[model samples]
Target: MKFTKILAAIVTTAALFSTSVASHADALTDRAKSGKPIRIGFAHEIPWAYPGDKNEPLGFANAIAVGVLKSMGYTNIEPVVTDWGGLIPGLQADRFDIITGGMYITGKRCKNVAFAEPMGKFGNAFIVKKGNPLGIHTYKDIKDKDATMVTVAGYVNVDEALKEGVPENKIMQVPSNTEMLAAVRAGRADAGAGTYFDARNLSESAPNEIEPTDPASLPEWTNNWVAIAFKKEDQDFLKAYNAAQAKYLGTPEMLEAVGKFQYTKAQLPGDAKADWICANR
Candidate 1:
């Protein structure tokens, strides 16, 4: 009788464990269909995915995610805010189902996470004081003048500057564009390098304090494309999201969603495959 009881207990425990494993496997697909809240991670990059006045996260990436997910019946989206460096690590730990911010897709990142099709494309721009005090229109100017410039800690802007012969001592790595702009304003940095959208948003808020230098005039700073990031195991979720993205991108609704940040149709990425981008990067 005691032996029978033990066997029954073991079977029950095994069944429970199996059920838990199945639920874990289902994750976004099952949860999304069942009306569970989808968690997305984002950094506080201006006009990308930052908290608005109401403390609700609103920005270009957030808008796109909301539109696509809502169209697919996944209305319950929970935003997980983190710093720039924490985005990938948080996603790997299952802290969020997706990184909704404009994470740039590169060969290195491709090995770690699967990326959706390219959504936004941008080149590096500089945030300088109103009158361009240092006459810093390009990275070369920063290098030539031996002026210090600020860039976000994890962004490729720092790399762009380094490649242009801007020494390490001349580059200050801050955490956000807000601080970078502040660094320039405080004379801690001669300029701040970031995405064109970032410069536009920052300058618009304080037009008298700063302005964005035209990146189009630079010869070496080619445009870089950005895409939504997903875990490698979420193949099914990626497919569903991509299908929705195809329908949502370049539509009137898409423009309306991101237009508040001054995103133009020209900023939309072309039909370049992620693999090609990864290799070319």
Candidate 2:
């Protein structure tokens, strides 16, 4: 009788443990459905995700994320701002429930965080001092001219520069675009590299100081896309988020939400799956 009692107790404990694990796995999705606040982490980058006049998160990625969340009945959202390099770390630490900054989906990142479908695609561009000093038009030119290039830390542009034969010593990784532009203006670097739109935005802001390289001059290898990121373990939440995204992405509503941030129909990611990008990139 004692043996049977012991066996029953073991089975009961096992069942309870299983239930607990299941509950934990579904907690994020459940919280969303219940109208609880879901935290979104974003980096301050122009036209991507940045603070607005009221310090509220605004930009293309932020708008898209908010739209999808609202469509899913997840109305309460809290925005968390951090440096671009800290976004993934913040998500992993439970500082936020998702990352919506115009984060690129790379293979290395795929190993760390789960990505939703891609939302936009773009190529690289360089911001050179007015009059094109150093003749820096492409990543290769930075190396050929033995010039230094600046990019935001943790940005794929850094990798693109290095791949084009620009030595590590010639690459300057700053904490943000503000520092990146400062470095170029201070002559600490010959050029600043970033997404095509990012470079164009900065150059337009300071036409007398810098100008963006011709978009057509950028190589095909420098092209990349952006997506939202989530913790790898939050598969349930990710599934729910993707379902909402499927219904909203590429629709007029999606474009309307992001168009103000300079995102157009051409920027919309069509038939681009995150899994394929992760595997190929």
Candidate 3:
């Protein structure tokens, strides 16, 4: 009687285990079919996250984000705009499920949240005049510019430009890169410092209004990294995102997608084909 009772107990446990696995699988399928939109919060920064002409949250990262998430089986996705500085607080409050914007994963940032594996990298670039006619090649070049330097307000790039030794009084902070670029073109400033991709793309798309160049003299790199942040302790979502990133990064198709979005030059680790894939993908 004891042996028979034990065998029946074991059978009951096996049935319960099967039922749990089946339920979990059903949940995954149900979530995929829900048609409920995954609302993503975004902060504006050109070439990555920013508003469209109509003020819709739009840009490369915004675009890439929709594509990637949809490919992962989400159909309803929304881009909600928010102030850059307030993004984290909103995430912490559960205002959005994810941040589909351009942000780096750093040690300081990790204190508040978790991060996905690196998506790509970025390098700071200098926007100089035609022919680099100033002969300025380093961070020290700003002191030698004989003119002001421009950057956007509240951006680390401004701090970086300032650290290069330009007097605080000589630095101009504006609301956007457009304004900063205008200052450079109008000769209000000798040059501007910002993302490498933005400088290069502006030169390619606009032609002659602003020229893209690198500071050849700075002893330190401005900053270069790639990764995205998430709300605290959200390991379930983090696992999925990291899995998606690693899987995507290994494919030729991923490179093609990056090209489609034009993130090639800014994505780091020196993969020309990776660039091509990023651009094309």
TM-score of each: 0.85, 0.90, 0.69
lDDT of each: 0.85, 0.88, 0.64
Candidate whose TM-score is highest: 2
Candidate rank order under lDDT: 2, 1, 3
Residues 1-281 of candidate 1: C-alpha lDDT, one tens digit per residue: 99999999999999999999777754678867777789989998877887766667688888888888888878788888999888998999999989988888777788888998888887778889999978998888999999998988888777777778999999999887778889998999998888888888788888999999998866543578888899898888888889999999999989998999667898888888777888776
Alpha carbon lDDT at 4, candidate 3: 98
Query: What is the total number of backbone clashes in candidate 3?
Result: 20
Q: How far is candidate 3 from the true structure (C-alpha RMSD, Å)?
A: 6.4
Best by lDDT: 2
Deviation of model 2 at 21, angstroms:
8.3
Worst 10 residues of 3 by lDDT: 272-281
Write model 2 residue lDDT over 1-281, tens digit each, in one string. Answer: 99999999999999999998867756577667677789999988889999887778799999999999889777788989999999999999989989999998888899999999888887778888999978888888888999999999999987777778899999999998888888988899999988888889999889899889986797775677799999887888888888888899889888988889999988877787899999876
For model 1, the stretches where C-alpha displacement exceeds 4 angstroms are 1-26
TM-score of 3: 0.69
Going through the candidates in order, what is the number of backbone clashes in each? 0, 0, 20
